[model samples]
Target: MTGPAAIRAALPHRYPMLLVDRILTVSADEIRSVKAVTLNEPWYARLGEEPSKADFAYPDFLLLESWTQTAGLLATRSEEEPADGRTMLFGSMRDVEFHRRVFPGDVLEHHVRLQRAVNDTLVFEGSSRIGDEPVLTIGTVTVAFRPREQLDPEHAGRNSAPLTGSQRGEKS
Candidate 1:
């Protein structure tokens, strides 16, 4: 499984921000990544109670971020050019639905399907699941692509080929 370090190498994300745990599958226009739920996650504190049960829950915003990261991985991993100098900004969210509660140890899987891509925009439908049950789903979203030079300074960095979902054992 590709850990955070490998993901960082593939994508320009660092500690406290990188969300994808391991890429699990990838094709030309699709990618799936895994995020093994852990009790030590920073967001767990907001859960009110230390997740004593396997059925612990996660906040919706965090789940959305996780799903968004998966979408980025799909675009970066499958694209012909995955230069670190490029970045994607989430433009809009549509038809998002939260299903079952996601808890620690759930090992949530994100399946991102690229619906369309043209010019510098990409639309994807993403779903997060625990095994066969879906925990979250976003029907659609449009993300804008931009050169790293145009992004905020805090988002610039370099991660080479060691981060491809195919290169890493994480699958996509």
Candidate 2:
């Protein structure tokens, strides 16, 4: 079991972005985590002075991100430290479905299982529930441990000028 402080140490997310509140269980193949949703969440404050019923619902994307972060922690549990300068990046997400609305005061329980891991890529199956009631399901999510240079816009695509005809070894 892990608390918020330990979860923060495992993941890079912080503040309003740090979604996982507690880790219930962890192993080589699976992990379970918790997140207590509350009206005090940063996003809820953006609903203006008078929020409506629609504004009370948590965004689906953040829900997915929270699940992803849980899976990421499971994936990296074996490593003594983050692998050099590599970081896990979401490669793909498929067959995601939301069964019911999630709101403040809901305690989200996220369960994730390792489907496969090949080289730097890891695949997982995940779901979330609110007190035994299913709230979200994801068929598969793929994440890759990639070098920061590959993902940083400042370093990527730095020198890609189009080649002239002469540069291509053809008549100009």
TM-score of every prediction relative to native: 0.76, 0.83
**TM-score of candidate 1 versus the correct structure, residues matched by position:** 0.76
Which prediction has the highest TM-score against the true structure? Answer: 2
Candidate 1 residues lying further than 4 Å off, grouped into runs, are: 1-3, 46-56, 152-172
Give each model's whole-structure lDDT. 0.77, 0.87
Task: Encode model 2's per-residue lDDT on 75-160: one tens digit a residue.
Answer: 88744456667777888889999999899999999999999888788899989999889999999999788886555545546664
Instruction: List clash counts for every candidate, in order.
Output: 4, 0
Q: Model 1: how large is the Cα RMSD against the reference?
A: 10.8
**Per-residue lDDT for 103 in model 1?**
72
Model 1 agreement with the true structure over 1-72: per-residue lDDT tens digits: 456666777666676667788887778788888878787887665655544554356667878887888888
